[model samples]
Target: MREPVDARRTRILAVVHARGAVKVSALASELEVSMVTLRRDVEELARTGMLRRGHGVVRPMGDTGPTTVPAARGDEPVGEGAAVGLVVPERHSYLYETLHGARTALEEAGARITLHIAPQMAGAERPQVERALAAGVHGLLIAPRWRSAAGEEADYGWLAEVGVPTVMMERRPRPGSVLHAMDTVCSDHWYGIHLAVDHLISLGHRRLVLAARNDSPTARSIRAAFAEIAAARPEVEEWSVVLSSPNAGPGEPGTLEEAPDLTAHLRERGVTGAVLHGDEDALMLVQRLTENGIGVPRDCSVVAYDDVVAALASTSLTAVAPPRAEIGRAAAELLLYRLGRPTGTTGPVRRTELLPRLEVRGSTRALLRPAD
Candidate 1:
């Protein structure tokens, strides 16, 4: 006969509490059992509201007392008496600006911010959230590192159950899920892409191409938006979208240098204009096109996202300018609202979506010739 489920659950909870956290497989091995048996035990304990399991490990039972989430940031150092935890995913300047804006806003409002960065999972956010809760932080402003909204609620719900208010920055809804409740701030990607497409179409670009990364939610949105816009333009008949690996190094089999294939694809489809997802890649794409004796804006027009340091660094790039400082300030303010320092009201559940402006530069010109 199988061991009683209640006894197994109690043993699992006890082990999780005593060990701080335990993997399901570890529990199985330690108890001289199979993985399936341990999983059933963990599931029963979870249903009873004893411990929380995510990814692979089981987190401790919730503290019934009121909880505070400390702001943790990777850009700043950890200190004693820091009541808020700010979790910055990685140390990029753009990300830093967002966090800095949040920090400045919070400080002006007399809130303490402890910034923590996790290079990967183990190095930062997971441990920081745990410690902040243990140290008495009542709320958390987590700039989640998820690429998509799917499966995010399970990770974040744990924070809510423990009585911590969380604000996700730069994230939008997944296909069948809604992660937006407290507040979410993201670039107006669909509208931005609309501007890009319209600019190309107006410039006589009947054959257009989009070069974008296929993995990110932002990239996926851009593609979907592109398709929506294209379907409306019957005059624009021949267009092709070439997906490229965003981080593939130069000269690799799948690298952006595959621009030759991209250009070939464009030529075959009679493409005369291109929309780039990132400015860095946009500049490179233009340079490659020019090297192939193609005159940008003269023979082909282009537009890209983010006219920041990358766009400015390029000699010429017609790009979308995300309101960087404003986005930073808005994220900070929303977080403060969650922290109870209401700046402006979008009612109780604060939500704001910011639009991006198109910056027309030297890269795009009116298309004079028809696709041949």
Candidate 2:
């Protein structure tokens, strides 16, 4: 036996009016329904002027004073606006492109976006988030800095406590942890690594090497996918080179010198194909190889991870281009959907992963045919 949708929602409104402001967790427990279900109901009621949602609590509409409630159902109408907060880690090139896409989508939906720029240090995002909340944002889109492997838990638990709908851009929950229950949209780095490996295998490359930056969050996924592929294809000999530090800033030379002689290492391992994590590392390796009289795609083929600096290289490199703008647009759309409905109930958590496109260029070619 089950209560009707309207009946359940009516009960929810009754509880809100009775309690003044009720915590979401408490309301969900009282209704004997999951938090997801309760959230959907609350969202719908808020849209129709029946209730108002604040950080972590629901209250009866107009209880505090006279107020104007935005219509819950309608297409994008001018002057009907909601404020959304966006937080990102600095103005990096990729992040800028992602922000552009988010802005475009928000504009199309008749929403206002407030930008918050935070540094890449841990705990630096909390103040920015507080500022957004104080500014009366209805929802949030955030890209948190990477946490160390040993960090006790996800640092964004405050998001759930605050009770506003949130979407994480380009971030995933730590492995084996369900601590944060928020929607997410990110590029599929694992799939991109698979594409890189498959492309190399198709080019008669049996001896392969993966040059990765150990500092990147996506490094784990890339390594896992590469190992899985290598294990399945036992004939391919694969090795890895992890850069100790991320690439140095512009005009900083001798960074590669600090690293081991990668050229000698690759030749010693008999690796004929290499998948480099960034264009900087790939180009640096290629320069060293050329100086050692090794010809790229003649004796060795190289594929880079990010397409940001791929074409700028002296020898254009084949690269995996993550759908940066697409990720932003998809994230913004998901947040808008959450705000528009609030209490919309679905079975599974909402997560969208966009695939990266392999941009083939002059850097990769088939091995020369062996003499019959």
Candidate 3:
């Protein structure tokens, strides 16, 4: 028997209320009705302010938008007109790439974004975030500069008070922390470090030194992952971590006008293979190693992290590449999904991690002989 028009409309309302949003075609298919009939029903419901219409979709009244919605049915621009804020550290090229990726996706979705760069200082993120909030953004995408554990903890109070949907980009709060329940997009740095270590071990490298910065969360995570991976490997005879650059951070090993004597340090311990963090430090260290009579991959094999400029180095460094732009894309996509729900909607939070890949190049090679 044909469902009555009033009955069909009521059912549609129930589905929309439950799902938050529904595509027009999906609603029609579920009701076993034609597009023409569904349109008439939707129009009536919208006229009564019981339903909201979007590009080929329908939502319960008071909904902001749809979450991770598909391209869906008809000829209409798909966008929510939401205003969002983005925060990232200044003078960071890697994160700049992430920012660009997010900007494109949000623009396509018809959302306007306000960008703020937090200078490289402790507690720099909060004030910029306040500005964004004052601007009345509906949501936020932030990559906070958690230079220290205390700095990260300090932001928790204000972040909790933001009172808007937020997504973190490339920053993972420690488990059991207040921000742990927040949404995040991060690179699987542990896996990236494993790839570097595994590659070195496979090439008969027994001794390794990780020259990395203690500056950012990514650098710290890589350092910790390297330590863990290096210790567990039976083939790895010795491993130690050192500062990648002068004035890097955390003030271990102190700064020197002349770069640390990495060549002497490696030779003193009979260490062979080295994994360097970031492009600039790796390039500089590689040059210094050359000047000190250590040929890359010939005297001491090296693997650099952060492929941003690794391949462009003089020796073309073998490096690990975290998915930078993808982190931004996914972060933005998740934030959009968060914005779709009605105000005060509470849902399960997600932590997304994208894996990084190793780019093999001339800087790393098979062991030709024992270290001289």
- lDDT by residue (tens digit), candidate 2, 1-372: 888999999999999889777766567768899666887888899999899986446889867832333434443211225788998877456667788888888875557789999876656678899999999887898876553433224464665566667888877776445534668898899889888888988998888877765443555566677777767776686666555224421112322313456677678888788888766667887888899977887888889987878888888999999888888999998887677553544235687899999999888888675671
1-372 per-residue lDDT for model 3 (tens digits): 877888989999999999888877567768888666887888899999998987567898889866335631233322356678999999998899999989987875557689999998878888999999999787899998776656677888788778778999989988898889999999999999999999998988899999988777898899899999999999999999888887666432342323367989889988779999888889999999899988998878899898888998878999999999999999998997777555445479999999999999998888777443
Best-to-worst ranking by TM-score: 3, 2, 1
Highest-TM-score candidate: 3
Task: Quickly count the clashes in candidate 1.
Answer: 22
Between candidates 1 and 2, the TM-score winner: 2
Candidate 1 matches the true fold with a TM-score of 0.66
The global C-alpha lDDT for each of the candidates, from Candidate 1 onward, is 0.64, 0.73, 0.84
User: Which predicted model would earn the best lDDT?
Assistant: 3
In what order do the candidates fall by lDDT, top score first?
3, 2, 1
Better of 2 and 3 by lDDT: 3
In model 2, which range of ten residues has the least summed lDDT? Answer: 248-257
Worst 10 residues of 3 by lDDT: 71-80
Q: Candidate 3 — number of clashing residue pairs?
A: 0
- Model 1: per-residue lDDT, tens digit, 1-372? 787777767777777788766555456768776555776767677787777765445767763322222343533322212356677677444456667766765654345667777563322457767777787764566665544333244455454454555665555655334444556677788888888888888877888888875534566677788888877888678766666443522222332333335656666777888888666667777777778777776767778776655456445788877665666667766655554432232256655678878888888887774454
Off by over 4 Å in 3: 1-79, 250-259, 370-372
